[model samples]
Target: MSRRIKGLVEFEDDNGAVVRYLRHPHGGGLVSPAAHAHEGAWLAETSYVEAGAVVHDGARVGPGSWVDVDVVVGARAVVGSNVHLGAGTRVGSGARVGTGARVGERVSIEPRATVTADQVVPDGATVGGSGTGRRSGYGRAA
Candidate 1:
């Protein structure tokens, strides 16, 4: 059975394990207790930070953003509204994702990288990692 205590949910997992998740006060999003959301980090009510996720200090996750399990949102990173960060995605510090951006799984958004709004980042693509900022064949939505 699931229980709520002071905005924290104790969910009974299918594996017979009960886990704890804290609901964001501002956005009502679910953040796993195992996840690390810095005190300075901001999460919209409509966002979800799954288990093993790390939202560093100063990072901002907009509304409707889903930070899947094991995702790493670096310090000062900005995840725009309605953004979907696939599992294992690493958003380097200072990176900025525009609204409606869909980042594929295992995608690495290097530090200081800027993803335009409504952009679709394919799975396993590397953005702004050393060599070239953005990989070819990726751009804003039509």
Candidate 2:
């Protein structure tokens, strides 16, 4: 019988890393108390931000999105609905991930990069950069 803490949700990755999150005051999303979500950041209902995740100011986290441990969503970045940002991933400022994208761990989405909808980003992938069109993250970063 595991005694779960009130208002706390915990998830364990395949690597045995356990992440936890608390309820967000504004949108009923799950945001870890240890995580940093700016007051200006908009967290959609049903989103989950794990411990150690940082969502900077002006960022909009879409519904059903998951920000894993140690992930940083830069200022003004827009994470699409149902997007999954794995551990150690970094989304640069002004970057945008399209809806339903599943990004693996340790991924880096550069500033102003635009990931297409429903795209699958592999682990350790580097995406977005200057001159990147809407198809950024569809392939390796130039």
Candidate 3:
């Protein structure tokens, strides 16, 4: 696939090294100048992403998917294709958020946690597990 950079900017990395931030033409969200997205991923124009975030190939972020700082979305993870992700929510790497899943505001999905395909996660809920039992609140500290 041919990918072209639609948005480009310079930012300082964690090591203080200057780096280039690139966004694909498919991304319309408020992606930070420090964030990077693949060509096939779709980030809505209203969504926001902080620095150190990445949306991989074929993943779709709905109009309001709030990708927090350092969040990493796995390849082909369908996020809010039909539903919207609440503001300020964070999705960890290797976590697959199914289509039409309503992830409430401020929800945090731990790394490797699977929200299942088309599952609904309520607001302020913490989800984590091995993607086998559909566990919730397993890695959250209350």
Candidate 4:
């Protein structure tokens, strides 16, 4: 069965849709459900996801960041304030995208991969050592 891990931020009503979280000791915090879009196939309105984070379509985030879902940010990779996704852009599990480094189309980042700190990933482009070799896997780095 699928279960959620502790410390990670996830939606309580969105079928366990994962959101961003603050690292323990560093500042583990909670997701804020404010000024957000609670409909559609993505997170909506006034959210601010941080670098290396992700969200997928159909994933509902009230006012937080999506960091995990298959441990990858897909379609609606939603993000919120101060949230980090690490890597692994497989946010297809009802993502809620926000600010910060979002997962691009056909892109796959490694788990716990830091997508923050000026890491720019284009559409259909892979960033870390995951998925198939090459930048996007479907082809070579352009």
Candidate 2 local distance difference test against the native? 0.84
Give lDDT tens digits, candidate 3, residues 82-111.
555555566665566766576666677775
Tens digit of lDDT per residue, candidate 4, span 57-122?
A: 344433344443224444433344434444344533322233454444545544323344224455
Against the true structure, candidate 4 reaches a TM-score of 0.29
Q: What is the lDDT of candidate 1?
A: 0.84
What are the root-mean-square deviations of the candidates from the true structure over C-alphas? 4.9, 3.8, 8.3, 13.3
Q: Report the number of the highest-TM-score candidate.
A: 2
Candidates 1 and 3: which is better by lDDT? Answer: 1
Of 1 and 4, which scores higher on lDDT? 1
Lowest lDDT block of 10, candidate 1: 133-142
Give per-residue CA lDDT, model 2, range 1-142, as digits (tens).
1123786667786777876667665666788888988878889978988778999989999999999999999999999999999899999998999999999888899888887789889888898667535545345433
Name the TM-score of candidate 3.
0.51
lDDT of 1 by residue, 1-142 (tens): 9888899888788999987789865456679888888878899976889989999988999999999989999998899999999999999988888899999988888887888888989888777734334423443322
Could you tell me the lDDT of residue 111 within candidate 2? 86
What pairs collide in candidate 3? none
Poorly placed runs, candidate 4 (over 4 Å): 1-45, 48-99, 129-142
Sorting all predicted structures by lDDT, with the top scorer first, yields: 1, 2, 3, 4
